[model samples]
Target: MIIQLHGRRHLLDVDLDIDIEEFTSHVLFGPSGSGKTTLLRVLAGLDPLDEGELRVDGKVWTQGSAIKVPARKRDIGLLFQDHALFPNMSVEENVAYGIPRAKRGDKRGIIQWALTQARAQGFTSRPVASLSGGEAQRIAFARALARQPRMLLLDEPLSALDTPTRESLRNDLRLLIHTSGIPTISVTHDRTEALVLADQVVVLINGTVHQIAHPSTVFEQPADAQVAAAVGVETASAGSIVRRTNGLAEVEVEGARVFAPEPSFSTNGVLVCVRAEDIALAKEQSVTSQRNQLMGVVTRISPHGSLMRVDIDAGWNIASFITRTALDELELRQGSTVVAAFKAPSVHLIPHD
Candidate 1:
């Protein structure tokens, strides 16, 4: 589906234009109050559409030319963070509520398909009030699918679940949406969700579209320092271009002359962005072919999911993500002497004023 939309919302201070083609799922990601939900709500036509032209699958839904289609006529399904299920209704009835009467002739079949696809089977007769957070969420997803929408808009649908449930259900949701053959736009603030589910990712910041690209591109090579931090490239250090040769930059950072990828601008100063995962930690000052390396003492070791985050201070602190096995092999601990090494291309240089 192809969409072109532009609008301004005064109260929210949102003014922007975005065009996207979602043959698969796209994640609209940003921090809270960053207009992620506003964009989703506008696309779903749940509220005022913020004065823009919205076209889907070659049909004009809105042109601001007296050609506005109401929400129901847009052939879209929407899910909210809260599920919005009827407290008094059973799961089946709640799912059926989203199916319009005109389409009710085969409603049972559609509801069953949705429930099965959502992994919500055997809970059709269960009361909404008695369901777990994850169970209720599956019902909500089934309700959205009951409409047989051409496009789906989800606003932080998995945010309400506990950590373990959210992670597990994320894969399920990704598989369900990909197999359903519908273009989807899901709003989220979690980068991990975007990484796992999005075929494309739109990074919105402070009511503006900051960057839009593949999850890997946006994460590995963010447009700026702010976007870098958002994608978990937690290492940002002040640096200066001592020299540029052969498209490589020699950046002097905190008394260490490190090499990194050259910047587009010929600025002398920059904020060097190094993803923790891209940086590797080793015991002692090892010799390596990597362009950037520094000898430092391990200052902290922290647990992150199944991986370990080791912080090293060689005058300047650097962080790296490695497997627990690697950490144990290296015997990494606070105050242990180590070296952090990364390739030149792994360092993203953001020019500073």
Candidate 2:
């Protein structure tokens, strides 16, 4: 195992128990104040723990013995949101700065390799101030990789770029990082980035680790209502398990019958989550393979950049996503009667109080 934290307490009682293997990539994801950054700082040796043991690759980074390794000697690379390149240096020089004097003869080759990997090969001679936002961000990553550290730490690396640049750079960065075969722990609030890059995701909430799992599993089966809400599944409604058979469970939500798969709820007052994308909108009751269906009216339409969010009133408000083309084709407007259908496997059951 590459990382282990035990008996830790800071702001909250953080008794984190996780074991990640080397060369595995994962994301520390949560809301702004969810301690994602704090956990990274702890791993980077920037924060002191009240009580815990931290081991990286079997080397004790921290423990009750008061033996804590310093950040500089940890041989970890960090890429911050802001590209903190020196204004006076060129891109190539910035990356070369991290190369030790013993390897100074190979500085040109190292810089070339880093720039090629980042797809910033042509911008090497450009002054730091002369490069575009995306170019500078790539150079920052190049500098970090120039050190060839065992682990890399990233803090919202794509948050500063524009949408187009962010998208392109996200793909390039993921390819480069995986090719390097180094264990990486990245912190990001962006769900798309987490889904695209992480093999596993660690959700932090209020100085504690809430749940850790694969990206698909985390989104499909959130550990609780709070975690579900954090990931954009926000509607919380009471329901009861009416029947269970054939790997499916019938849930009655406010007198409406909805089918879900393998629902573990045994009593009343259970909360269930259904993603907006999972809910499909239709003009009438149509024959399909989907198991859950409800009659609803279009209550509101919200435009979200490239997507349209349709709010349906089905005894309770249910949100659904539709493409602009689909919305226009359906001629969907306020007060339109629509049928909301979703697969039984997509409706997730969250623990209810």
Candidate 3:
């Protein structure tokens, strides 16, 4: 099934235009209140579009001129952030709720399949209140899948759980979605989750779709400063393309000139972006294979799980993540002067708006 959306939700101030493909998943990613859930509701026909249209496999659900179908008639599977399970209903009955009237005759068999698919069949007769958070989540997923809808909508499906459970459930959810061959649109504030589950990623911010691209492309080459921050690219500096020659461009930031591969657009008033992992640090200036090197003083040191994040002020702030052992051996700390080096290809230049 294919989904095409072209409309504006005035309350959220978001205009939508997207073509979701068959057997693929797209992640709508942003921070809280970015309108991710509102867009999902629009797709499920729960929210009205003030203008434009929405089509599923060529069947019109809504248009600027008319509302073609109601929410009940739209075959959509939606799993809310809270799961929205029936507290009074048993596991079997909750799954059966999503099944249409035509499928009611074989509801028992279908519900069983859904429960098994979601790994919730073991609690088939359990009351909703008795199930654990993860168990409830599985039941909710089972209920959504019971409808065999044209598409699936998920709103922060695992955000309510703790770290370990969330990680485990994320894996299970990915496996189930892949196994069932359902087209899905999942909303999340976590970029890592978006990276894990998305075939295509739509970066939304301030009720607008900022950038839409493949995960690798979005992570490596963000469309703008907002996108850079959204994808966790923090080592960014404002500059202009001072010069361009031989497929390379020189960007001047905070009195220092840096070189990077030229971008498609002219890079005047641009932001030079590089990931923390791409930078290497040394106590003294040295040149090996790295294309660019600059000296700076360590401004901050923080622990990031197993790695140590070191921030250097090379005229401007540049961050590097290195092993704790290496940091100790190098005798690096706040106020220590060091050299930060990275390849020209590692720097991505985006035109500043």
Candidate 4:
């Protein structure tokens, strides 16, 4: 399905032209209040169009000469963050509600099949309130899938659950949704979720799309510094490409020379990006196998559950993640002189905007 939005605005001018072709799953990712949910609502026919067009499978859903289809007749199943299940209804009844009344005789079989697909068959008779967080989420998915809609619209569907439960349900939901063979458009603020579940990712900011591409490409090669920073890669100080050698280039960052591998930027002014986890900490600089090395001092340390984030003060501030065991073994502390080593290939050169 291809979706094109032309000259549409709500409080701001939103002239977007997006093309999604044969994509079974897509993720609309952005920070809070970036219009991710608003875009989804517009696609689902829940929100009135100001001025634009939306087409699904070449069928005009919204346009100048065409009347918009009502939400109920759009053949789209929506799953919200809250699940929106009736508290008084049993799991089976909740799943069966979306089915046609004349086909009620097949509701039991359909409900059982849906539950099996969701791996919640044992909770068929339980009240919606009695189900655990994961169970309730699975039931909600089953209910949405029971209708056999042409497309699925999920608005931050797993955001309400706890971390562990959310992770588990993410895997389960991916499998179930793909097996149903319905194109899905999921809106989420979590980058990790978008990386794991989305086949294609669209980044929206302030009602505008910043970039749209595969997860790997987006992380490895961001469109600009804003996109790079959004994906957790720290921006480096402004520098000029001093020298270009055999598949490696040297740049001067604030009077300090840093080496990067085969950067695309040959101009004088450019910005670089390196992920925190890509940097390695060492007690001393070695000349053996490692290429890129810099001397820095540990300025701050933050705990990220299993990993520790160490902030280094070099020519430019750089962040690196290390295990707690490494932190204790090295006796790392503030003001300690540490060697920050990273692969030349890991440094990404992004065009400054």
**Quick one: ranking by TM-score, best first?**
3, 2, 4, 1
Model 2 lDDT tens row, 1-353:
45776645455346665554533788888888777776777777777677777787678887743648988888888888888898988778899878867778888898888787777788776779988889998899889888887788888889999999999988887887788777788898888998888888988777777789998888878888777877778455767777888987777787578888865556545787898988888888888998778898899999976889999889767899989998988889999988989888888887576
How close is every model to the real structure, measured as TM-score?
Answer: 0.88, 0.92, 0.93, 0.91
3 or 4, which is superior by lDDT? Answer: 3
Number of the predicted model whose lDDT against the real structure is largest: 3
lDDT (Cα, tens digit) per residue for candidate 4, span 109-176: 88888788778888777778888878887888888888887788999989999999999888877887
The list of candidate 1 runs beyond 4 A from truth reads: 10-21, 49-67, 323-333
Q: Give the local distance difference test score of model 1.
A: 0.81
**Segments of candidate 4 deviating more than 4 angstroms:** 7-21, 63-67, 101-105, 263-267
**Which lDDT tens digits does candidate 1 get at residues 159-210?**
9989999989999989988887778889998988999889988888877777
Model 4 TM-score, 2 decimals:
0.91
lDDT of 2 at 144: 86
Clashes of each: 0, 0, 0, 0
- Candidate 3 residues 73-116, lDDT tens each? 88778998878999988888889997989889999899988988
Model 2 alpha-carbon miss at residue 66, Å:
5.9
